[model samples]
Structures are given as C-alpha cells and as structure tokens.
Target: MMHAVVVFETLWGNTEQLAREVAAGLGLESTDVVDAVSAPAMLEDDVDLLVVGGPTHAFSMSTDKTREAAQQQGAENIPRRGIREWIASLASPGRDIRVATFDTRVTSPRLPGSAAKKAMKRLVALGFRPAAKPHTFGVHGYSGPVADGELERARRWGEELAATR
Candidate 1:
C-alpha cells in the first residue's frame, strides 16, 4: 500500500474538496488531506507521494504577503493568499520525493496555460519531478462551485497517479 499525503490551501474551499477527492482516489486505508497552513510538522517525511496545491495567485501559487503586495500594486491576476510561500521555504536539498501539483482558478481561456507551466518549473526546482500538469478547478470569480467536469477530472487524475507507483 502506498502512503500519500495530500495538502492544500483554499480561501473558498474548492481546493480543499479537490484534495479530499485525491485522497479518496488513492484508496489508502491511511491518508491525510490537510490544510497547508495548520499541517503537522512531520507531514512530509514518510509519504510515498505528495500532492500540493492552492489557487493560482499572480500566475503562481498563492503567498499571503504576495497577495497583499499585489493588492497594493493593483494587480488583477493574483491568486488567493495561502501557504505557497511555505512550500518555497522547504529545504529538500537532494531528497528523493515524488510530487504532483494542482491549483484552483477560474478558466481564463486566455492566459494560455501559463500558471501550470510556472507550477511545473517551481516543483522541479523544489526537487520534485513534474508528475502531472497542474490542474485548475474553476470558480465564478473567487468563490467556486467548481466547473462541471473539474471534480471528475481531479478524481481521474488521482487514480492515474496512484497507478503510476
């Protein structure tokens, strides 16, 4: 049985729901879907796989301070504020970890896949392989009902990831 940890940050709860579905798909008798902010300290060490996500803020993952700075700068493209900065702060340093990522955002149909690209780059730099494209669950402005197919897609993504290892 594979041990997996799925953690996420959400302002409007859409992303958290997605994380839970990911855990369900893994079908682990022991699994955790936790809020990134209050996550336990040793959450990362023993998992066979790590899934992390948040809403896209400023074309990347959300950081509490960056959202404030963007709000002050009048930037319209910031993602909601959360623990993405904490993710960047982690010092994996040559560790071997398999990771996948996802995000929740309104479908731009115009940004042309920019956020996923940025997320893949960040994940690789943090010593994780880009296992899958970063997914974006939809929202009507900010609070979301999640687009029609988004949850199903997420569930399918989880199954696929589980099958990979």
Candidate 2:
C-alpha cells in the first residue's frame, strides 16, 4: 500500500482546497493537509509519496519578499517560510521518496512561471525521483476560489498520480 503526504503553502486557501481534493483522489484515508506553517523537516519513514504545493509568486516559488508582499495585502495568516524554504530545509530522508509538486497560479494571457516545476527540480537535486509531472491548478487572482471544475481536475490528477505508483 502506498501512503502519501500532501503539504502546501496557501496564501488564500485555493491551494489548500486543491491539496485536499488531490489527497482524496489518491484514496488517502484523510485529507492530511499540512500547511507550510506546520510542515515537518522530514517525511515519515512509511510514506511512499510526497505531494508538495504552493501558490506561484513573481513567476516562481515564493520568497521572503513575496511572502511579505502577500502579508502586506492583508494576508494575516501567511507563513514565514514558503515551500522553497521548506525544500531547502529538508535533510536527507535516509531513504528514497517519490515526489510530486503542484502550484496555483492565476490564468492570464502570459502565465507566470511555475513553482511546481522549480520545486521538482529542487527535489530531484536532493535525489528523489518524480512520481508525476509538475502540475498547476489555476486561480482567478491573488485570492481565489479556484477556477470552475478545478477540484474535479485535481482529483483526476491525483488518481493519475496514484496509478503511476
């Protein structure tokens, strides 16, 4: 049996909703959505997959400056460390872990660069193999309810991810 950890950094809850849906689609027993504020330094030994997510900021992963901008925009609950920092903080797992990454971005004429893609690169550098392609779920704006039918898409994506494992 495969067990997964779904962790995310959500400024406006869009990523949170997506993360829950994805975990549900993976047939996970519960939506153990770990926010960046509460993420641990390492994955559990029994975990088979690690699903990481966050909102894209300034065409890539959120930095301290971007997090500060989010806070300045009345985001009272913004975390001090984003996924980038979390990835950097992770120590070697002492075992191989399959990894997947997703990002939430606004739908625009020219989309911002994906945090998911960058996160995958970092994870690969740390020596984890990817279990799925980097994914992006679109938001309407900075603070979003997510696009129409995105939750279903996320669930389907999760299913696909599980099939690969």
Candidate 3:
C-alpha cells in the first residue's frame, strides 16, 4: 500500500473537504489528512507521496497578509501561514518524493491564476518529483460550495496521480 500524507489549509472549509476526498481516492484513511496550521513541521520520511492543497488567495498561495485579512473578516480558525508556510517548513527529503498539488478558487472565467500551479513549482524547486500537473477546483464564490462534481473530479485526479506514481 502507498503511504501518503495530505495537508491543506482552508478559510471556508472547501479545501479541507477536498483534501479528504483526495485522501479517499488515494486509499487513505481520513486521519491521513492534516490541516496546514497543525501539520508537522517536517513531513514523515516514510511517506511515498505528499499532497498539498489550499484555497487560492489573490491568484496565488495564501500569504501572511491574506491570512490576516481573512481572520479580520470573521473567518474562523484561520491559520497563520497556511500551505505556503507548511511547504517552507519542510526539509529536503534527499530522495525523490512524489508530489501532487491542488487548489480551490472562485469560478470567475476571467481569473487567470491558480495556487496549485504555484505550489507545484515550489515543490519541484524544493526537489520533489511532480507526479502530475497541478489541478484546481472552482467555487461559486469566495465562500463556496465547490462547483458541482468537483469533489468527484478531485477524487479521480487523486486516483490518476496514484496510477502515475
């Protein structure tokens, strides 16, 4: 069996729910998903795959400023540094570790960026191997019930990612 760890950050819980769906697709128990704020500073050495995700803020990963803004606007349990910080907190694992990234964003057709793409870049720069292209799930708005069937799509993506690994 593959050992995978999924870590994610969410302001409105959309991303967290996606994380669980991905984990299920990866054949992992719900306990394998960890919130970014509470994620271990270092990833476990034994994990075969590492999955990271979060909500896109300002077209990219959430920043300290964005997180703060969310908290001030009545968003509860906002994490200080989210996925961007959690990715930074990790040490180079030396051996190649398969990784996949995803993000949730508003459904504006004009929106031109994704945090998942940025996260995938950072993971590669940090020496992890990308198992597949980064992916995004759309929300109807800032606080969202994810677009119809997105959770199922995310799960399929997760399964495909495992197949590639």
Question: How are the candidates ranked when ordered by TM-score, highest leading?
Answer: 2, 3, 1
How far residue 2's Cα lies from its native spot in candidate 3, in Å, is 1.2
Number of the top lDDT candidate: 2
- Cα error of candidate 2 at position 141, Å: 1.1
lDDT of each: 0.68, 0.86, 0.85
Clashes of 2: 0
Q: Candidate 3 lDDT, tens digit per residue, 46-79?
A: 7889899998888899998988887787778677
Over 4 Å off in model 1, which ranges?
Answer: 40-44, 65-81, 108-116
Deviation (Å) of 20 in candidate 2: 0.6
Angstrom error of the Cα, residue 21, model 2: value is 0.6
| Clash totals, every prediction | 4, 0, 0
Candidate 2, 1-165: lDDT as tens digits:
677889899888899899998998898653357987688887777888889999889889999899889888877668878899999988766678888999999876457599999999998888788998999998887887799989999999889888886
Candidate 2 residue runs with Cα over 4 Å from true position: none
Rank order by lDDT, top first? Answer: 2, 3, 1
lDDT of 1 by residue, 2-94 (tens): 778787777667777888887788777667787766655454566677788777766666666746664575545444335555465555536
By summed lDDT, the worst window of 10 consecutive residues in model 1 runs over 108-117
Give residue 92's lDDT in candidate 3 (0 to 100). 77
